[model samples]
Target: MKTGSLRFANIHLQEGPIGLLTSSLRKGRLSQTYIFAGARSVGKTRLAKTFAALLQCLEPVTGPDGSAEDAPSWRPRPTSDVVSVGSAEDAPSWRPRPTSDVVSVGSPDACGKCLSCRRVMAGSHPDVTFLRPQGAEIRVAQVRQMQELALLHPYLGKWRIFIIDPADRLNESSANSLLKILEEAPEKVVFILVAEQVERVLPTIRSRAETVLFQNPSHHAAREAIARVTGRPADEVARVYSLTEGAFGAALNLAAQDLPVTGLLPLREAQVRFLEDLERFSGQVQERVNEAPSLEAALAVVEDPDLLLFPPLLASRKSLVRGLLLAESLPAAFPVLFSRVFLDVLDKARKGLDKVLETVIARQKSAYAAEILKEMDRQFGMAVQNLFQAQVVGLLECLRHWNEDLFHFSHTADETWLLNLDRKDDIMALSLVRGLGFAESGIQLLSRSLELLSRNVQPVLLLEHVLSSIGGRTP
Candidate 1:
């Protein structure tokens, strides 16, 4: 087996930033440590692995060599192309490059026949390291072990590569451990750190590495990848790709499950209806401060990341708020004006700002646009923090309520909610509430509360804040 390499693979290569980065690396000018910053499912991990493979490929490739020994290592076999005219015609499958190429990924591009490549593809490669958070965070101990491993020579390949996924998950200690490695990395020891937010990592780490940004792929590219990988039709692939918001992993995951296009109907309808609801609701509240509590509840549900409908709603809310402020209409929308305290949060709902920015760019002043962007970012950050806190709150509330419900009825001092928590859904629900121990009861209560609150009735939403008096518990 040869070392794994993704160089010149038959995969449908998406053009743009990722393509540019890959092209540069193929020319053998890779950075010591690379920060691949992008949204989830933007192929950050995939690209990093591919680059690592290329760097580790033992049979180093050069441009179309004239010598016989330098001949192409692999060639595409015979295949028929779809006819240009009339009915869709069948195409023959290309041979030589087996489907295993997609499955077995490693450095120096895993040649199918090499023992090293085969072992790596089989997940037994001693030289290749893929490090991810074992739990909520990547601990310093885990990172230290990785560093120790990095200090040793590669058991097989010339280069030793370490890929840290979601590198932002590293706690301060873990990150600091990695910083030491960066300071004294041995020659040919490479680090590829993939993160959803590059800024979250230590600035020193960012300064030591080149930042390679990965932009979202177009619907066309996502569709092609889904089709090629899943053998699905173009229309079906397009549907799933669109529904996933062009997240390749989400789309491909759906394809693997063989879910039908109709499966996305509710998700799509919810997105549209939720946006309209927020626009109409925000307009109504724009003149009423007394309505702040109710509006907040509604916004919470709309912005629920699980629903994926909040971005548009929040974006609409931002625009409506700005309009009211500009027109000196704060008195009319007292509740909304009060909520404006959190307006800095509009940033996390990226989908909305992406849309709003496009609309405002044509008419809004550059200075005003800059201000709005800044506020949006603040709001976005706040929204994320609030969401996390809310989840934690939800769990505590569920636990308190579960015990209250149990003790209130049982009238026994020796009882425990853990013993009587029923139903898998209840447990699943509590897990969603976040920060609560993943006990069955906690999960169930969270699930029930979320379901009840989403209906927009505040009275039925009492459970949402039941834990306000509960002891503050850290996640």
Candidate 2:
């Protein structure tokens, strides 16, 4: 019930995959193999270690009485710091008391004063073994050695524990070898396999062990921790938690700094500017398609995928979706031509979406149309800038092909297009916004139109003449 007790109490196990492991433990029927799966930094490895410690703790946990509790004085370390374990004589001292904080098996939760705890924490525990690859992946040799060690009797405690920090990192041969042992694991021997992505582990391995899933702490939990550690006001802590995307470690790092966590100011400013420019020109999108640097600045804000920054390209689609939704609700006289054109641009933008952009999809409905358009414009503009002149030329050509399809839609007729003449005129005003060579033609206009766009100059005057010729304005 203490502030940090839930951290180690395995309370999160009450729900999700972690709950399965908790149920098994309460029944005194622990699985020989267990996989802890989740995203990176979401606490899979951390939970695996805690489960291992609980299995080998000298003191019986007081909960369900599946096992008798050890006498008082054995308690787990509240953090990730490991407690080294060496021998059986240290067993009595190694017992860890229940804690709210989640601690790994190798962490200080083992009571370093005990011989077993000291050896394990120091990475020299005889009965405790760790099998990890030396480089990019875990190889078969490591698995072979593990097999050899697993068959041996424990040198100290009643049980021997093996922890594979990144179990999914094992190569095919190594995984198969480990799976063989799991199929026939000895009594009193436990294997904890920690994986960021469970599906990557072989199905045979997955089927044998109990699975535990750990979610990152909630934003509220992170904010509270930040306040406690930094003595900062709740408002500042709340702000930092928002910036960190609810990551506990990230929030803690920022809170520890003497300065406030407002370093993201530049990013915010660039996002704001990009959005403002987009909205101001939503009705004249064609003229402003070349703001590359500003576009790059927009993408940079959410570079860290876990933080879930909304990218410019995805933002564009959201804007179009909103516009489409609005168009559906508007009067028949309202022109939705610009929204249609913007939607065409968005359909093509999805091809290069990064993970961060995909995560932002859920927020699209809540985002403003103008804001989405701005982000997309910025990203597309920047992308065009990065390409060679010829590549950019080719892209515009492709865009033109897509644009030509729009004219055939029944919605582009005079009656519907006239109300939004200012926006429609800009498109009609262009020398050529359609047909086979439209990409080539579009590129030619880009340089000239971009300059005019930056100056806030409207070239739609000519568009009005063209629309009038087609009876668009009179309708």
Candidate 3:
């Protein structure tokens, strides 16, 4: 089959809620209302859109008698970059050859070449409507408009499909209005609700529709699907899969980028210094910025290669957390290769952790620990930065990632599960320094620093306190 023939809905319909849709289609038991539910970025909206297109297809894959038949093209023939469906005559007449066997659940479908399908796919179909969140919630007015549209007969297609994306975003008034439609919607209309969190949707709404559960594709499935679309190398496809948490749409976004995402230049140096300095439990992390304009240098080094890195000269605290998570999974560790370099420091940190864990946790108490982490996270986001504070957060985030990996390596002895698989060599080298005990304390040290920063503690003071608490040199 040619590449474009792969309609996403048909890909794994044999499994999960998709299987039910296929069964319903074959048995001619289609639901007027469907709720497609799943994790974020796991194809809920894509599935909903494709299903809506199918409902609007003039010659759907399933024939009039629901018999096995030639599937019509699911994609509109290339006319213009913009869909701008002009006339029915403009649709290409290419039809997929019929299969003699009973139509399988995997039947390719939703021929897009037809005028009706093109209009729906192009989002120009007079009968199809999509209601999404305005800002944080889907307001009542949008539902009223959709309800008004539902009363009209099909302008050019068989069904009037209203798709509510992130269905959970529907406000109370909107949800009640939607419930009214669910109770007595027009015969030719279909309602498809796509949501990441099914629980957030009103129960009244849920009771009136067929709930279809979508799922995240397996790593292998993600790799294949993305590779088929992008025609990228296997390694590149795998990398994208890892980065996007296996969401096809998210994967497609990054695959379109000019280059694979590498962290800003300082990410590398900062990561290296953080890991190296931990071995000494010293003040070297600050030393990297000791030179004037060095902070600016680090900030400058954070170039925008592809995947939006902390926005131009602005790094949100949220981005730092994301960067740390990236460091955990994607292996950005560099610079630290020799275990001999930081052995003494790692030893110092463990002893210091023991002493401080008692004193600080006692003096500051549990409430302080809980409150500080939130404060540090909040402050990092307050302003642009007196001096690339967000960049500093990013650096420490990388360090935290290293400590996590080392802790996992020493305790679990499973490198396969390591997030820094690319930095396996460096991690292994560092793993030999004080093993699990020190790695655990190192994690605590970073955690404490995060909390300390939240308590209106100066960054330098926080760094020095961590160093001292962890029994490290201050210089």
Clashes found in each candidate (C-alpha, N, C closer than 3 A): 35, 41, 8
Off-target runs (Cα >4 Å) in candidate 3 are: 1-14, 62-108, 218-221, 224-231, 256-475
Q: Following a full C-alpha superposition, what root-mean-square deviation does model 2 have from the true structure?
A: 19.0
- For all candidates in order, the CA lDDT equals 0.48, 0.45, 0.54
lDDT of 1 by residue, 1-475 (tens): 0112344342233345445554443333445677788876766776666555544454433332122232222211111121121221221111122233332221123333355444444445677787766434678878899989988987876567888988998999999999998888775577889999788899989888877877766545556667887798866665455344345665566666554222212222432443464444333322232222332333333343343322333233223322221222223333333333222232233344334333433333353556655643444344434443342233334344343433323332222222212212332333333223323344465556565554433422343233222212222
Q: Clashes in model 3: which pairs?
A: 73-111, 73-112, 74-110, 74-111, 74-112, 75-112, 279-345, 376-454
Give each model a TM-score: 0.46, 0.44, 0.55
Off by over 4 Å in 2: 1-22, 60-124, 216-232, 239-246, 249-475
Instruction: Order the candidates by TM-score, highest first.
Output: 3, 1, 2
lDDT string, candidate 2, 1-475, tens digits: 1112112342332245455554454333455677777765455654555455445544433432222233222222211232332235533343335433333321223332355444554456677787654444677877888888888987776567898868978889889988887766676578888887788899878877666766655444545656775688876665444333344554455555444222222322433443443433332222222221343233433222222222232233222322322222433322233323333333333233332243343344245466765645455444333221222222222222223322322224442222122123333433232333442433345444434433434334322222122212122
